[model samples]
Every structure is written in structure tokens, then in C-alpha cells.
Target: MTTILEAKHVNKSYTVHQHEEHQILKDINLLLKQGEFVTIMGPSGSGKSTLLYNISGMDQVSEGSVYFAGEKISALSEKKLSKLRLNKMGFIFQHSHLLKNLNLLDNVLLSAYLAKNSSKEVIGARALRLMKQMGVDGLASHNITQASGGQLQRISICRALINNPDILFGDEPTGALNSSTTAEIMDILHDINAAGTTILLVTHDVRVAARSQRVLFMLDGKLVAERNMGKYNKQQNIRAREAALSDWLTEQGF
Candidate 1:
């Protein structure tokens, strides 16, 4: 498969009081292939979330570089990077973070409208299509307060895909959901990946990692280990896949 994203010797750090340097990510190198569904798993404070931000250009790297579509994104100007994110990348945080001022449909169309790459009619149609596919079209006219957590999350996913991003970066996208709701969101993600959008996510949930094609284990700001669990198939034995990943995660001391 083609390489959609790459991180070469990526490092991230911050300065605190008295100029003390605290490092969060260390010599992290990664490659995400086109159309691949991958996840990063680690304990809290292991820098998994930090890595996601740096690799996706949401945060600047202290050292090394990140590339998207063969361009060195870490070196790009913030203005260019923001434009790139708006055009080619999508993001989902732990919270929906939707704008309460705007109704659901308008919220989904917000970034696309900012891109101004298409007419309102075209973007509106695509936003509605994505909302319908995610099963939240009926909530379009409603404010965010009118929806459940799961419904809001689906709307967030629609918002993320509004511009047809090449890859979706998720930071624990299902962390706020109940068990059944998590399953439903994962199913939606599976369908989205099957439809050819690459997904890279960070999660503490074994079930979520089990559904991915590969899992990368992070520890103490390092890429400790990775396992190719193979592609997820709804027709396959999911429990068995989860068991296999659980055992591997155990060996990693996760």
C-alpha cells in the first residue's frame, strides 16, 4: 500500500518553569499506509495522544518531521498547515466539541464552508449525505442539546468527513460512550474505513483496537511494539480477534 503519512524520528517536548525541558515523545517513527485502519494503545501519560497531535500537525514537533501526501508538514507554515488540515485531514477529539450556536447540519458544514472549495449547494448536499450515512440526518435542524451523546458523536463524524479528508485522526473518539454506544460508533467507523478513508486513532478500549488492522503500543514516550492483527471483518469471529489482541497487549504490559 502507498504511504499516506510518515513520522521520522519525531520528538516533542515542552519547557516549564525555570526552562526545565520535559519530553513527551521520543524518537517516534511511524508510517500509515493508504486505506489502513490503525490504532495506538497505551496507558495514560504514555504520550500516545501527544504523538497523534504531532503526527497530524495539530501541534508542532520539537524535533524531526511529519509528512502528509509526501509533503513535510512539520515545516509548513501554520497558515498552510491549517489549510491542509481543512482540506485533507479530519479530527475527532474525545468530546464532540460541536458549536451549540449552530444547528447540527450547519455545524457539519462549517469547515467545508470555510474551505470555500465548493458552492454552498454542493457542500450542503455532501454534508446531508454524510449525515444520512452516519444515521443522524434527522437531527440536522436540532441544536446539539437535543441529541444524545452517541448522536452528537455521529454528527461529529459527519463534520469530520464534510470535506472528504484523506485520513481521519481520532483521539479516543468513543471514550465518552456507553458499551452499546461504543459498539455502534465502532461499527460506523468500520463502515467508514471500508469505504476507503484511512483511520488512525488512540484508544484505551480493547474492543476498539481489536477492530483495527494494526495496533501500535506506546510506552514511556517510545514506540514499544506493534502487531499486525489483520483487517477486521464483520463476518469473522470478533471475540477471537479481541482475545488475540488482549494477549498481545498483556505481553506489552499494557
Candidate 2:
């Protein structure tokens, strides 16, 4: 299988002043294969979100490079990057960020509109199918304000999948949900990955990270370690994962 995404020694820094720069990431390398599900784990300020933004081209890197499907993302123009993001990548955030005025069906179809790929009739059918798969089809006529947190999250997921992206990036996807809802969402993501979409998820939740096929641990703006989650149960997996994380944290004196 071909690699769908690659990050080569990617570095990023922020300038708080004219001469002061804060390094947020250093020599970060990552490669994601088709259908692979990887999760990034870290404490606050670990540069997890920054890495996602850089990979997604929402933020520019200060050094190194990002490539998607063998094309260097850093070399692309903003318009080209937007096109790539619309057609090749899907995103799920901690917040829904749904359009308040659009009905659930329209909200999901908006992704197709942004990609400029399908007619209204085609997108409407696709959106309804996605909503049904997500168990939100019954709420298609409802507005964002009318849905529950879980329902809205499901709708957001439907919106993300409307474009059939090859790669999915999720930031704290289950952070705002109850335990049951979290499990539901996780199961849904697992099913999606099983259906062959590459997934890169960032989260502080041990349970969520434990479910991934691979885990990357980060601290102090760098990737400190990685672990394989092949056969471990959630308890054993999280314990081992956190131990590796704790060792890295202590080594860095963080």
C-alpha cells in the first residue's frame, strides 16, 4: 500500500515578538498509510494541534516539509491547498462548528459544495445516506440548535464523511461527550477505519488513544515515543502507553 501522508522533520515556531521565537515542534516525522488509524497522545501544550494544523495546511511550518500522497504540501499555493483539503481530507473538531442556519441535511451537503464536485440533487442523496448511517437521518430537517450533543456530533461526523476523503483528521472528537456517546463515536470511527480510510486522531483521552492501531506520544513540542496497540486491552494499553509517556516526560523534566 502507498503512503497517503508523510511529514519529514517538520518544525514549527511562533514569534511572540519581533525577536523572540517560541519553538513548538522540532524534527517531527510521521507517515500514515492508507486505511491506517493512528492517534497522537500528549499533555497540554505538547504541539499536537499545531502538528495537525501544519499537516492540514491550516498553518504553515517554519521548517521541514509535509507531503500528501507524494505531493509536497508546503509547495502548494493556498488555493491549491484548499482544494486538496476539500477533496482529500476530512476533519472533525471538538466543536461542531455547524452552520446555525442550515438544516442538518444542508449542513452535511456543504462539504460537497465546497469541493465543487456534485450537484445539489446528488449531494442531497449522499448526505441523507450518510446521516442515516450515522443515525442522524431523522434529524435531517432540524437545525443545529435542535440537536443534542451526541446528535450534533453524529451530524458533524456525517458532514466530515460527505466528501469521502482518503484521510481523516480528528481533534478531541469525543472530548465533549458522555461515556456512552464517546463509545458510540469511537465505534463509528473504528468502523470507518475498517472500511479503509486513514485516520489521524489527537486526544488526551486514554481510552480513545488505546483504540488506535498506533500511538504517538509527544511532549515539550516533540514526538517523544510511539507504541503499537495490536492486541492489548484498554486497561493494559493505556497503562503501558502512559508509562512510556511518563518516562519521556520525566526525561524531559516536563
| Residue pairs in candidate 2 whose N, alpha carbon or C atoms collide under 3 angstroms | none
TM-score of 2: 0.91
Best-performing candidate as measured by TM-score: 1
TM-score of 1: 0.99
Tens-digit per-residue lDDT, 150-183, candidate 1: 9999999999999999999999999999999999
Candidate 2 error regions (>4 Å): 231-254
Q: lDDT value for candidate 1?
A: 0.96
Q: After superposition, how far is residue 112 of candidate 2 from its true place, in Å?
A: 0.4
In angstroms, give how far residue 9 of model 1 lies from its true place.
Answer: 0.5
Number of colliding residue pairs in each model: 0, 0
What are the Cα lDDT values of the candidates? 0.96, 0.86
Off by over 4 Å in 1: none
C-alpha lDDT of residue 230 in model 1: 88
TM-score of each: 0.99, 0.91
Give lDDT tens digits, candidate 2, residues 1-254: 79999999999999887889999999999988888899998889889999999988888999999999999998899999999998889999998889998998889988798887888888888999888899989998999889999999999988888999998899999999998898899889988888888899998876676668888888888888877656334355455755655564456454
